[model samples]
Target: MYCRNCGNEVSEKAIMCVACGTPPLAGNRYCPNCKAETSPDAGICIRCGVGLINTSNHSEFDWLTTLLLCLFLGTFGIHRFYTKSIGIGIVQLLTLGGCGLWTLIDFIMIVVGNFRDGNGKVVVNKQRA
Candidate 1:
């Protein structure tokens, strides 16, 4: 494999690139299959026809933390605030979580991994990269 950030050769199992000091798949500058320079917006490598990994969509929010916040502070929209959804957070806060119904629904969504961040990406269960 190759480092997507630096186009350097790397082990497939390697978590971080030695040359770039970033996760091997954490970038879009190069194709991991052929080490060819890739356009930032390209979804697939023109040279290798491999699907490009989209690191940007990776969630920055922790699932467990969001779940806890939803369970305890959801009435105040703390989880939405943590996920950077300030507009919704404010609305939720002002409405008191839609009279608590919205808060309950959000808590269920978090528990079932259906909640998303401000970017519309699913909240990740793992630690941030």
Candidate 2:
């Protein structure tokens, strides 16, 4: 593998670039597969034609924060709001917290990874990853 940030060769399991100290897959400057220079906005590598994968592993969703919101402010759908699902949040709020049942279900969903963020990526345990 190669560091997309600096075109430096990197181990497949390396999360950050040793050369640049950035997440190995965070940048769009070079193709991860071919190490060919590329446009930042390019969807596919010109040389390898492989779809570039984002390297940054940051999650937009905060599991602990979401759980707290669901437990304390669930009636107002504050957790949904935090996750950028404003429409669902509004529905939960208007429904009097989905009669409380919806809130409970949402909590369970979050715990089991059924719930996703705006970016459609699963929330992970950062320490474990």
Model 2, 1-129: lDDT tens digits are: 889989999999998889999888887788989999989767789898999745343345778888888899988898888888888899999996799999999888877766765555555444545
Give the number of the best model, judged by TM-score: 1
Query: RMSD in angstroms, candidate 2?
Result: 4.6
Local accuracy of candidate 1 as per-residue lDDT tens digits, 1-129: 999999999999999999989998888799999999999768899999999956645667889989999889999999999999899999999999998999999888877767888888777666443
Decoy 2 TM-score against native = 0.61
Q: lDDT of each structure?
A: 0.86, 0.80
Query: Residue 33 of model 1: what lDDT?
Result: 94
Clashing pairs for model 2 are: 25-55
What RMSD does model 1 have? Answer: 3.1
Cα TM-score of candidate 1: 0.76
